[model samples]
Target: MSDKASLAVLLCNLGTPEEPTPAGVRQFLKPFLSDPRVVEVPRPIWMLILHAFILPFRPKPVAEGYKGIWKEYGGSPLRKITQSQVEKLQQQMSENSVLVDYAFTYGTPGLVEQITHYRDKAERVLILPLYPQYSCSTTAAIYDQIGKYNLGQRDVADVYVIKDYYRQSLYRKALAESVDAFWQKHGRGDHLLMSYHGVPQAYADKGDPYYQQCLDTSTNLAADLALAEGEHTVSFQSRLGKAPWLQPYTDVTVRELAAKGVKTLDVICPSFSVDCLETLEEITEENGEYFTEAGGKTLRLIPCLNDSASHIDMMAAIIAPFVDVQATGQK
Candidate 1:
């Protein structure tokens, strides 16, 4: 599609490094951990741990985890999958004279670079976060970065933000369809697990609303799937620091379920639009091993909605109210 001079659309997702190597991961981690929205500790203290300890020692293991999920295609599944989503959105939403592209808030193809690219073309811009549920650590941080860059640019396009869609009906339907499709293929498991990334408990206590929204998402999905209370469950994963975060840790929960004689499990990560380290490494490779070793017979991972038609539709709906388009999709 040709770049137009009046409108630009940018899709933003948490990024990954170029590859699954230590150097690649280290590069990715630097900006990610440096974000104040993410770390939240005093800069002096966090920097010390980040440089002296975490950066020095953590890269190898994290790299190894990335290696487990690395595709033969070279780049990270996170970036590749997210790029697929962006391309589809661009194709579907081509009618508004908008040039659609995506950028990472961290790592290469960064936000500033994407904005500069778009600024050269479009007079108006929309920043859409891929996260369905907003956390200060995720969505708000993207807003902050964009705000900082737009500080003194008179030539910059007018910008609009698409907020969270945790309660959107189309989103819930798409999620339910994914689970049902997996069940049809893989056979019904003893339970369906909805695992989301964890945030610090303090964030919720301070009114972040991320945790509550996660619960509501789980409840809505379960009802749509006609799941009994004990037949479905929700948990959290990906706690980065020592701070107390959301409860029912995913790994521990999987182990405990196996211990209770529940075998044959299927897990879906609704929090992630595209599978990444947390979903691929933590849930599929790591927790799958953990669950099986803990006595569960089998564990299957239902893939994320990356580039899926339903997912694209839901994302288009989220931004429809902001744009002047009569209908989305190509003419």
Candidate 2:
């Protein structure tokens, strides 16, 4: 693989609607929800539920939620931020014998297309799924796609996939710095809420490490920020269906904290690499209302790291080991 002249790095993330409309939402949701890694239910029954019950009604309301955060640039916040991340990473590595690009796990610029684009130009490809904490539903689904793509090819590039980086020192430092910077500008709140996106409890019971990784990330960040025992809490958000999910659910916890006289809360979603409907609509808008309605003065959302200079530097560091700079004659 080192014999090839160039290297291609592919950054991937969960997708968003192409546009903030029902049809767009449906297009994104269909491929996303249909994945067994995501849904996990028996397919025959799940398909009926998805087609008859879900698709008919879910798209419009979801589209409306997306519209609340759609950018003037004509896409969801996740798409815009991810594109910026790719562009910055490319510029950051411009002098190296490497090319950087990004794609979605389920939407436009699909994984297969991006992988194919690099097949001829580069001898080696590194895939980095942008989930800090790995879960079967998210990270494993990416592997499934790559596996499917590899099945059709006689010749494939040398591929390296980063499974997770939840515990990397640089990543944790970047997260802590982002939070500290937020506090420096806005001041600290009564308590910090580190809310991660939830998965069904059964997934953890079956040995998914996502729950533990989220806890580890929160623990590391809290220690970095020097928070006392009572100063921070961990919860899970964006649960679906009747099945039990990792709990101390965010909405319930927010209401309870406000009722208990905890005022001026600080909330951050550690699970999201970029702000999307979950953070923008669900956390900032919906759950913010829940807190204030329950007597809290404010629920301040600390932004994701996104494409900040620190974040790009951290990304470059994480991918450095997989890149053969000596082989490519990079710096």
Q: Largest TM-score belongs to which candidate?
A: 2
Clashes (candidate 1): 0
Question: Residue 47 in model 1: shift from native, Å?
Answer: 0.8
Per-residue alpha-carbon lDDT of model 2 for 138-232, expressed as tens digits? 99998998898888878754677899998988889889999999999999899999999999999999999999999999999999999998899
lDDT of each: 0.84, 0.89
* Highest-lDDT candidate: 2
Cα error, residue 125 of model 1, in Å, equals 1.0
Q: Which digits, one per residue and each the tens of the lDDT, describe model 1 over residues 63-145?
A: 99888778543668887888888889878877666577888899778987888778777766788888889899999988898
Error of 1 at 19 (Å): 2.1
| Native-to-model Cα distance after best TM-score fit, residue 81 in candidate 1, in Å | 1.4
Q: Which stretches of candidate 2 lie over 4 Å from their true place?
A: 1-5, 71-74, 328-331
Per-candidate clashes, comma-separated: 0, 0
**What shift in Å separates residue 269 of candidate 2 from its native position after superposition?**
0.9
